[model samples]
Target: MSYYSISAILTSAQKVPCTFDLPIPNRGFLDDNPGGDIAAHTPLPLPLYLAELLAVQQLDNRPLLTLDLPSSLQPRVLNALKADAKSVDLRGQEVYFFEGAARVLELLEEEEVGDGLCEAFKKRAAEIADHARNARGGTSSGEGGEFLRGLDEWERGLFRAAHDSSKAVRMWMGEVKGAK
Candidate 1:
């Protein structure tokens, strides 16, 4: 419903004067008003679509926090995005790759890899992530495919840990429910 309304507003804005007097509703008594304006009409209707688009533009223009991600991680993310592009929109693909790259940085930070080792690890992780994001969709993994393979191995380890964690939580919940 909101999507349709947004689409309608965008379409409407593209045509005609692109302006409308949308009502502003407020809950207050008509009398005893602070500004003496009608209680239900204290505010004014603003340009809806233009305002929305401007807000979205501002969000998209913000700098990414993954700027410091390792060079190695960047390639791995790229490879993964490329591989998954067929199943995702451009923006979604970009977001997935960016998120994966950030995750690599987080792992390194948490592990507290020393400066020299950290630089090396970061470089390797960035490369791997970027390559994964850039990998060909429905095509064979290219020459740098091993980097992606390493990422796959890393994810598998995380998956195992997550699976165990979920199982433990589920069992704990079951025990609590039985107690009740």
Candidate 2:
């Protein structure tokens, strides 16, 4: 992702669960307390960027914080995606679901989660392409409407690209026939 990409910024801003490995003074505001110390092992929701930085910082050869999978990539969500990737509302889970997951996976190294996400993206991409190609008059209704509404930002871009390309191809074919 580019440094100036809006999607990268949004993905970095998404919060992830992190547990402090050591007590820290005057950082309790992270856990909703002010002017107090944060105890060791206190779980807090921190931005992905901050959490990743803290988790990578070493204190006595150990990481300062342990990063946990964000709620969006938790087992329940993964199971739902595994069951039916197209039915899961990825937008509801996170606007930048795949990007955020990629970042978290970099820190946590959860191979299963990576596999699940890849599978989900593959399944959904096929569905998105089908919908994009078959959509009538640039409008979606019924099941297609609901599915389109559930697409994350990246998937929406894919759908738009697919839809536009399908239209362009059709126009080109019409032009070719006319010339014949």
Candidate 3:
């Protein structure tokens, strides 16, 4: 649902003039409210589609609202980005795009597919966690850092080869689950 909601909302929408007022119940009001507004509900001039997107974005507890939008939205969003290609700072759009991809990868990983690739991904992730723990969170110029850096490069190549045949699931669990 979030996937479709985000895709639909992200589409280049045309703004139309207000035609109706949506009355929403405004509970937990204070006594010192405006004298002119005494009704228990408020009439907002928001379109229904916008209302639903905002509602889901707020209510959905996923880390980044992880869900792949329809394929159409991918190109639509890409074209939108191209039009506004001055910078990669389409704040909200970037978040949705990235999160949607992550969600897709997560779903693919969950399927009963590509056990070898999964194993390779897990092995690389474990090595990074156990052996290269100190390689992150600081500078990487010391001797120990160089050793860890070598390990990282080897792991990257290993992952690339392991996932070469699997286009659907190219990302490791470490990259998907652990942002750091």
Tell me the whole-model lDDT of each prediction, alpha carbons only.
Answer: 0.36, 0.90, 0.35
Candidate 1 lDDT tens digits, 1-180: 145654343332321111112222341232344444333222322233333332234224551111233333345534544454222222222222333333334424533323333344345545443443332421245445433333333333333454466567677889999999
Candidate 3: regions farther than 4 A off: 1-102, 105-117, 135-180
TM-score of each: 0.23, 0.94, 0.19
**What lDDT does candidate 1 reach at residue 82?**
44
Query: Among all windows of ten consecutive residues in candidate 1, which has the lowest summed lDDT?
Result: 15-24
**Cα-lDDT of candidate 1:** 0.36
Off by over 4 Å in 1: 1-151
Clashes of each: 38, 0, 0
Cα lDDT of model 2 by residue, 17-83, tens digit: 8899899899888888999999998889899889988988998897789999888988999999999
Q: After the best TM-score superposition of candidate 2, give how far the Cα of residue 128 lies from its true spot, in angstroms.
A: 0.3
Global Cα lDDT for candidate 2: 0.90
